[model samples]
Target: MEVTGRRWLLLHADEPGNCPEPSTTPDDYMGGFCAFNFTSGPAAGKFCWDQQPDYSAFRESSFGHGILEVKNETHALWIWHRNQDLYSTAGDMIYIVRQPERCLVESEVP
Candidate 1:
């Protein structure tokens, strides 16, 4: 689904043993999840969650601010800064690379 102009993926663990069943009470639960690339898109060959990065910093109820700085048409810098962190510090950061030629349709290109 799309929220605030950003797209989100709903990941689920395919193997029962890889994840635990949902709990009735509110608690932190860790599980394996995966996001596959679209069959045909700029992100056609990219995948995530198979070797997932640590996301404990952004856990439930965590408050943080994020910044996405587009370096170019194909590269962007994403940073997440927690409320408790210093202004110059980044809790997490990543470079987002886009494959417009492979992912964007002709009509969508500027």
Candidate 2:
């Protein structure tokens, strides 16, 4: 995900165990998660601005808010702000889930 000011955050649903220790700037500590990259219309693998225009999708403004609702242990809904509202407005919303079979690494046997 692209954080503001041209900085970028890399995350993959397949291997999220390697996620960094959240962030301190803006004080939003991001926990590990699995999400669907709708920026590319469900293409193969995952989607990020490094290889696609996903960043442009939120080019309007960098300052935004979000709400994470955990429906279960493997599913969540993310709602992002558009920086254009006054009283908790809605912008982007998506249903994210941990697809173990589709987005995970297999254990190696010795």
Which candidate ranks first by lDDT, i.e. highest? 2
Q: Model 2: how large is the Cα RMSD against the reference?
A: 10.6
Error of 1 at 4 (Å): 28
Candidate 2 lDDT, 1-110, residue by residue in tens: 76877878766744536423322222334333333333344344343223334644545556877899999866999999877677877777888867765446345589
What is the alpha-carbon lDDT for the whole of candidate 2?
Answer: 0.57
lDDT of every model, 2 decimals: 0.56, 0.57
Best by TM-score: 1
Give the range of the ten consecutive residues with the poorest summed lDDT in model 1: 25-34
lDDT of residue 91 for candidate 2: 75
| lDDT for model 1 | 0.56
RMSD for each of the candidates: 13.8, 10.6
